[model samples]
Target: MDFDTIRNHYGILIVLSTFISRIIFNGFCWSYGTVIVQLKKQHLNISDTELSLIGSIGQSFGGLLAPLILFLARRYGYQLTFICSLLTCVISLFISSLIHNLHWLLITYSLPYGFANAAIFILGTLICGHYYPVNQHIKHISIMCIISTGFPIGYHIMSAWVFSSIEKNEWQIMKRHLAFIELIATCILGPIFTMKYSSNIPLEYQRPSITVTQNNNNRKSRFSLPIIVWLIGIFTTMSAVNNFLLHLESYLKYLGFASARADLWFRLHGLFDALFRLSIPLFIHLYPVNIIYLFPTCVFTGFIFLLLVFGLLYTSINALAILPIVLFSFTSAVTTSLQYTVSNQLFDKDETEQGYIYHVIITSLGLILGPIIGGSFLDLTGNYKSIMLISLMFLLISFISFSLTILLSNKKEDTHQSEQN
Candidate 1:
């Protein structure tokens, strides 16, 4: 695994291409919350809970389909898998744009579109991992995060320019336009994957050993109970974030901000999110802190900030919303990046893929639940404050669970050392 050769051959082109593809994919998937808000305003018959269910169904279905997509990637290669997925997305979006019935929209948007987006994301991640050197995996993951800052950036762009420009009742027109843009982008970028260099370089290039270990018992199964507990923490924390993102715009509207103004705040939140992710690699390069310590600290801090946001909402203080948004965005950004890095640290290469699958499944559960719970709270209370309170509780539980994981890990290390003595 010659690092220089791989770097020279592919350079940044691969990263840029994948970034563009992800931006296109996430731009639509993540921005659907804003679209849903618009849709609800125009189609007064559909309840918030129903709309949230549609979004949840898409995310949960995507999770359910991830293993199959991974298998397809393994069998047919990422290029072909991506092409097929993108085609499905294009068709799904087109169909969704024409739908007036909520049930029909659910079938087209929630199932095929969501599945394709998840497939593209997972395959893109695996492809990126394959291309980079073993030693540079963290750097690779960070860069991918930095590129994924595009997710929020894309949201901001769409919210500020595209969604804001449209008439309140013409949300479907916007969906149709988005479908056209996605169709063109897919056609142009899908073929790039067909090139020979697009395939993974080779398995031999992977690192010979794990870089991080919890104890002398390196033979421990990646699926051990401790790891499972840690994953539960991950799942809970991700659910909190997903819930926050889904409801943030609507919450702002509930707070009485105009749609355009609410979107501006959303865009600002994304800017901070991008900054946090982009700074992670540089922070590691400079500090070289132990991730085990750093990861939990970030999680706990974000939850605390979330508590503050809840307090602010309770007080009806609109001017200081930015503070919590920045805090939450920073926490969300770190969690998203570290989930990959920590997974790599915890598992052997052979087991990493399985770990990712489990992570996605757990995350999908959170994604599914976040909306339903939030929507239910909204429907029952006619406000988002209760949702915030629930999210705070979720984060608190995750913090305790992760803290226990660290403690148990240390206990295992102590036992391992005593046994050797």
Candidate 2:
């Protein structure tokens, strides 16, 4: 738990390995909308709803498989789980590139590939959580979030340089190229995960040991009314954000921007997302503010900004779309980091696995619903404005839920202190 320990050689290696692995895994996952859009234009006869369903189904399946992956990680170790995930990803991407039929593509990319994505992401989070001490968890997690921005960074750069330059017919080759890159990344970082230093030490060394009575109290508090409200907030926030992200490019296109321009806007969104994530750790350190309060504040502010921008766009001021992009990026970064750090704060060290499992399940529900709902709006109205409104409603629900949770948690704390007196 010492500061010096966190700055040691192995610590640096763990950070570097996690950075590379996350970039490879998330880069492809986030880039799916662009790929799907291209596929719909060229080869697929599917409607917007159906295409969105692909990602939803894939994510839902991945969530369903998380417990099994977690089990394997416990029994066989993270190294094997990571290796299998990487191989599955590579094979799935390769198969996706070669497949001519939509159903086969879904079978390969949406099912096994989705499972691989979740396994890799969850494993990375668990690994990083284990590698750092409790005191350093937020800082390290923020660093991981910064590293994860590489997904969008790589996606944007590649779209601008590689995908845009290629003929429209050759867009599928991007998937094959991604497969090759993942193979190389796995080959390089996979060995680092197998190193003995990557294993998690017992919680006693990581944090102060809790007595039985305190443990019981912590367990009770972990699932109390406030925590349930917070979980609901997290679920709604994730769904709202994913709905925006999944359809942002398509929305831009609908707004009359060219495909290339839309891609650039997407990249711009990534840039701001990374910046906000990088800034959060510093912000938390400088201010004596509670993240539970800060999180919902950001969500509410972003939601309001999005509503204003959407209103402006509806009035034919299309150029102001950049405002919502920036707001959404910042809010998404805050919520994403808080979701991990808050879970850490709420649960006992030994119970984090269970806490994270619940987190994943809730997050997966959002992932599954976001796109389906957004796409359904698109189908129903044949317009992007309605979808934007729906996303705003989701964010509003999240903001209210989180605000109530914070208030109830404060009330509970007050009651506990009164009892002690």
Candidate 3:
């Protein structure tokens, strides 16, 4: 009947909390394409690459600061860490709304906002599985899958709803809108996470942030052949994917689609992505975390890239464009969802943390590089099709990287078995 009673059975709250954080993070990060277009109009003199850095710079900082985030979470509990980070996020967004200068926006908006979103999303999702019993395989996996779906779902919500509601020149209002979202999330979710551990949550959920002490003997080197190839695959794939996500709105405009239609297509693309991610519950039930399966996901993504490239080759690009966009979003969602679990399968039990940290770094590097490269290319050629071609190449490289990972990991296993024999 009371708040404590509600806190005791907080599984739904955890889901909602993590889900909303995902929306804010993914929506803002991925939908920066909308943000960049607005900024470009206001600052006609500023280069695209420079404006792109507003989002890219934040991602790089977030990835680079993963260790610090870990330390903070451990030292101060996930609840406190999330609260502080989101608070900073609220402040950052508010301050950024007032700033018109590009440099100041980069410093105020991107850096702290990126850092805060990373902290909240990482810490929030990290404890997600803790809510379910270890024996509840489906429950655990399904919860995570459901939570992860929030990313693209938010992407669509932001692109379609927020952009369509605000005029193109209303960049200032957009930042405040985002800040208010963060504020509401902070106010609501912060207290929910701050609840006592003895509530109806699982035993593993007793402490939001368990101390992972230094164990040099337990530290697995991430430089293994499989990991290197794995990182390479991820790096290349995200470089293309993030670039596409960041610039799709602009690219659609370039393709002769009206702004409303562009927003509609953009939202639909992300909707397809979110809808496809719903399969993760069934997927985890059938195959679990089979790293080998990721190879096909990458190949499919690359295949979609090829289709997208082919789609752009004609003047009647619009006639055939929607199909590839739908397919691309679907395949991309599958690949992106599996990325975290794949790292767990690739590394030893102890190495998941290290591998994940490395994973975040590599992913951030890709996100950072994507906008810069994509922006420069777009600036030079004034074409979005070229972006597709380059993205296709990146996907191809990722496919090859994943191939090497599978082959080398298998070969290493065989060699070890032969020696034992």
Model 2 Cα lDDT, one tens digit per residue, 262-354: 777777887777777777777877775767677788889879878876776666677787777776787777776555556765566656666
TM-score of 3: 0.87
- Candidate 3 per-residue C-alpha lDDT over 36-56 given as tens digits, one digit per residue, 9 for 90 to 100: 777776778887778767867
Q: Mind sharing the TM-score for model 2? A: 0.89
TM-score of each: 0.89, 0.89, 0.87
The prediction achieving the highest lDDT against the true structure is 2
The per-residue C-alpha lDDT of model 2 at residue 167 equals 49
Query: If the candidates were sorted by their lDDT against the true structure, best first, what order would they fall in?
Result: 2, 1, 3
Instruction: List where candidate 3 sits over 4 angstroms from the true fold.
Output: 1-9, 132-137, 194-220, 284-289, 309-313
- lDDT score at residue 332, model 2, on the 0-100 scale: 72
